[model samples]
Target: MSSAQCNKSAITLKGSSEIVCEYLDFGINSILFQRGIYPPESFKTAENYGLTILMSQDKEIKEFLSVTLSQLKDWLTQKVVNKVALIITNVASLEVMERWDFNIEYDGDQSQGDKQVSDKPLKQIRNEIRDVLKQVASSVAYLPLLDCLCSFDIQIYTKDDVNLPQEWAETEAANIKNAQCVKMRSFSTNIHKVNTMVTYKNED
Candidate 1:
């Protein structure tokens, strides 16, 4: 195949990063709605991946996620980000109740540099992501209910060599005591693969 033909079929690093970021946005929103971190009325239905997703309508939340995803896209392009976690905590006690981890894996050669590409079809990758989101939406059945008022924060794990952003600070890991973990399906863009897992406090 000619170089131009090969390039035409390739998924660029930036493209994969955007896909991954979009998945995280939808995944996090689904978790928030399913886990009741926010009121049901705070979300609105949106179509994506052939599914109707509930997305946040709050201005502050939208802005926060927008900025966070933008930053994540940059890191993902650099291939420095390893995992992105959503930590849900009890508002009154400030104790972590659940942690949703979207663990990332580089599916391409590291030495190929940022211009590397993946041959995976976008449609297939999106379908895989849709399946994961469906499982996330249905997870409320087995996951313990969050009975108290809760809040959430996003923690990003990056390579140690990465320079910390001035506004970002280090913090302790969000771990649940007597935790029960559930691993869900994963999706890949050929360049990047993401594994989904949830760890929650085992009330029993």
Candidate 2:
């Protein structure tokens, strides 16, 4: 490949990592808005994926997601972490209400080397991510409403051998009792593919 051609097509590990994190940022915000975990007033609409997306405006929530995804991007670039889960719980009862799991896998031959690069076009990947976000937005039609006050927490599932950060302590998996799951669309950047699913407490 010529120098210019390679430059146009190459997608580095760090670049793909940033893409995944950005998707999570928008995806999480979409869920929070649709599921009514936070008041609608706390979120503002922004354009993404050729559609309007509501992102959280709360300062603390924004900072939490920013820092968490920064560390996660590093793990993603290293191919150490496999899953990121967003757990929503009832604030009053402390009962697990809903869980959104974003399963990650290194895609194609890119996983074979330390320097990950893919020829997949960025526009195509963004379209795929848009489809996933659309599914999340329409999820409210089938998913149950959050009747009580709720809060959210993010959990990262990493490989057993990876060293933990001083501030990052391990916690038990936030499993929901009598859970019913709904599988959502998956998106890929050729270098990485993320499969999304939501498991919720079954009221029936």
Candidate 3:
């Protein structure tokens, strides 16, 4: 089958799970870069999803993401994770200034261990990523300027039946005060789908 045709059909569960994690890696890095949470010198440009994307080079940041994304991918493969939020906080006060929420949805009727092909193609998934990346790049037009240093945290929500990892802890939802939320684009594999929304400290 042609590349286009392949992307048009649903991919296996394992295949879709990997793509989801890859998207999270790129998405988080994109947010940090666009929001100026990290210094520009710490990142290098790379190509992904037909766009020039920035990947972090800072050793600490890279290690952190590697560990976090690994856990997220494993949870995703088990279909136990429900939500993943990227929380950006003020460096001084440690207050949550912005949040990038990625919510996952699955067919309730489908049980675990189903490695069925996704109904959506890979090509279509890239298109959705393109739209989101464009918005992230232009976010400075609306998002507040960060005049001070900032840090970020990844918060994951999972089903009650999940067995928590030794390092993972449960915490209250990171709510942004006086939030102004903007719903963004989404894409899916037949087995799993993700919807995105961003909430920022509204300056209103």
TM-score of each: 0.96, 0.96, 0.90
lDDT of 3 at 11: 70
TM-score-based ranking = 1, 2, 3
Clashes of each: 0, 0, 6
lDDT (tens digit, per residue) of candidate 3 on 1-204? 687876656477777788888888888898889888888989999899889989899899989889998888888878888999999889899888999999998743375466556666578877887887777777778888878789999999999988887988888888888999988888776677888888999877
List the candidate 3 regions with Cα displacement exceeding 4 Å. Answer: 1-10, 107-113
> How well is each residue in 1-204 modelled by candidate 2, as lDDT tens digits?
598898778888889999999999999999999999888999999998898999999999999999999999999998998999999999999999999999999897853676768888899999999999999999899888899999999999999998888979899999899999999889888888999999998888
**lDDT of all predictions, in order shown?**
0.93, 0.92, 0.84
Ranking by lDDT: 1, 2, 3
Error of 3 at 82 (Å): 1.1
lDDT of 1 by residue, 17-69 (tens): 99999999999999999999999999999999999999999999999899889
In candidate 2, position 81 carries an lDDT of 86
Candidate 1 least-lDDT 10 residues: 108-117
Model 2 misplacement above 4 A: 110-112
Tell me the lDDT of candidate 1. Answer: 0.93
